[model samples]
Target: MIDIFGTLGPKCDNEIMLKEMFLRGMTGIRINLSHVKLFDCKDSIDRIKQAAKEAGTTPKILIDMQGPELRVGDFDGVVSLAKGYYQTLGDEWIPVDEKIIRAMEPGDEILLDDGKILAQVKEVKGTTAEIYVKRSGGLTGKKSIRIVGKEVPMPALTDEDIENLKFASEYGITGIMQPFVRNRDDLLAVRNQLQISGCPDLRIYAKVESMEGVENLENYINDCDEIIIARGDLGNAMPLWELPGVQKRIAKTCREHNKPFMVVTQMLSSMEKSAVPTRAEVSDIYNAVLDGATSVMVTGETAIGEYPHEVIKYLVNTANEADKKIKQNKTGE
Candidate 1:
C-alpha cells in the first residue's frame, strides 16, 4: 500500500487527535522544522509515539531540515511592489543585498523570496545598486532570497538545522528531509553532518525545489534514500505552470532508482479552511498517485486546517481508491 504521510501541526498535535489521524490512514508523520521549536518538536514526537503505540501501528517520523535557505532581511510588514518599480532597502533600490554589489555587475539576475519574483541589477556602485524588478509580486518579511547567476556560498546545514538534526537523532526519528538540495555535494555535506551527529542510519529524503536541484536530480537521488517533490518553493522557483512536468520527471527518476518519492504542497489547500476538498484538489491527489508517486502529503490541510481529521480521511479514501483502481487496471480486472 502507498504510505499516507500527513504533516503534523497544531491540529494533530494532541494525543487524541493524532490517534484519530492514524486511524484515518496517516501511516507517516512529517515534522516541519521550519515552524515548530526543537522542544515542541520533541514533545510532538513523544505524543505521536504514544499515539502510535495505542493504535498498534508503527508510524514513521520524518524530520525536515531547513537547509541554507536565503530570505529577505527583516521587513516592516507585508510590502507590495508594482511592476517596473523598485524598493529601497538600506538606502538603495536594489533587487538583492548590497553585500553582492562587488560580485554582481550589470544585467545580473536576482531571485528573491524563493525565486517568486525576478530582478536584474541594472547598475552597481559602492555597497548599493539600481535593480529593475523583472517580475512583480508582494514582498513579505523573511521570504527566501537568492542570486540567479551568482552562486551564494553557504554551509549545507545551518546552525539551527544541526540542532534540529541532533534532536531528531536523540529522539530516534525514522528519517530526515533535507530541504532545498542544490547538488550532490549538498547531500554529501548533510550526510557528513548526520554522521558527525551520530545519525548515520537515519533515512534521508532529498527535496527537489530549485532549478539546480531539478537539474541534478539523478545525482541527488543517488545520494539520498528518498525524494520529496516539494512544490511550494518549487513553484516559487519556477513558473507554476511547469510544476506538473517537473513532478512527472521527479517521479520517473525516483522510480527508475527504486527510491520512494512523495508529492507534497497544497494537495488540499481549500481544506485548510474547509472540511471538504475542491474537485480540482481531489484530482490533483489522484493524479499524483497515478503518476506513480509513492506518497502524497497534505501540508496546511493537516497542519492548520479547520477540519484536520476530515482532510486526512478524505486523502486516505481518495488515495486508497486510486490505488485499488491502479492495481485493478494492472491486473486487467
Candidate 2:
C-alpha cells in the first residue's frame, strides 16, 4: 500500500473529521512541532487516538521535529514584503538566529517561504541584516529561511526538539521526521536522543531539505528508518526548475536502496481552498506513485485547507488509481 499521511491542524483535528480521514485511507497523522509545543498537543493526540479507534486503524503518529532548520519568528499575520524594498532581518522585521546574521555577507542571497520570496543582503549591522527584496511575497510566522550557498552553523537538534523527544512516547509519537538532516551525525544525534528518551525503537524519517542533505542522502537512507523528500525547503536549496529532477533522483535512490520514502509538500495544494485539485497537482501525485514513492503526504492541503476532507479524497483516490495502474502493469493484465 502507498501509505497516506495528513498533517493535523485546526482544520481537521476533531474526532469526527479525523475519523472520516482515517476511514478514507489516511494511514497516519503528522504533528508539526515547529509552531506548537508537544505538551500542548496531548489533547489533540487523544482525539486522534479516539478517532483511530472508531475508524478501526492503528494510525502512526509522526512528529515533524524542528531540528536545525532556521525560520522567521512569530508575527501576528501575513507580512507583505514588497519588491525593491529594504527590510531588516534578525530585528523587528523578521527575527532569526544570530548565526544566520553572522554567516551572511553583503550581497548574499536569501530565500524564504520555500523560495517563493527572494531577498539579498544589502548590509549587516549589530544583530540584524538589511536585505533588498528581490521577489515580492507574503511572509508568515515560522516560515523557512536559508542563505543561498552557505550552511549556517546550527545544532543537529534544537532544545525544543530535545524536549519533544523526551516526551515523545508519552504522546504516542511513533516516528520522528527530523528536518534539515545534513548527515549521519544529525541522524545519530536524534537516535541517541531517542535512546535516552527510552523510545529508541521509534522510526526516524530524515528530511532532505537542503543541498547538504541531498549531497549526503545515501548515508541518510542507510541510517534513518525512512527518507522524506521535503521538497518545500529542498526546492529553496536549488533552482526551482530543478526540483522535479532532484525529486526523481531521490526517489530512484530510495528504490535502489530498498528504503521507504515519502514525498511531501503541496500534493493537492489547489485543493487547500478548492474542492478539487488542479489537473497538474493530480498528475504530480500520480507520477510520484509511479516513481516508486513508498508513501505520499499532504501538508497545508489537509492541515489548514478549507476543503480538508475533499483534499484527502482526491489524494487517496488519485494515488490509489495510480497504484492500480502499477499493479496492472506488473501483471500485464
For all predicted structures, in order, the TM-scores are 0.85, 0.96
Poorest 10 consecutive residues of model 1 by lDDT? 88-97
Compose the digit string of candidate 1's lDDT tens values, residues 1-333.
888888888877899988988888888888887644565677788999999888889999988776866655555656665669765543433234455556667877777665767778787777676677878888876566666645565667878888777766678698988888989999899889889888899998888878888888987788988888999887766667988888888888888888888898888889888878899989988888887878888877888888878988988898888898899999999
RMSD of 1: 3.3
Q: What is the lDDT of residue 320 in candidate 1?
A: 84
What shift in Å separates residue 55 of candidate 1 from its native position after superposition?
A: 2.7
C-alpha positional error of residue 33 in candidate 1 after TM-score superposition, expressed in Å: 1.8
Worst 10 residues of 2 by lDDT: 91-100
The reply for model 2, stretches above 4 Å from the true place, is: 75-78, 91-93
lDDT of 1: 0.79
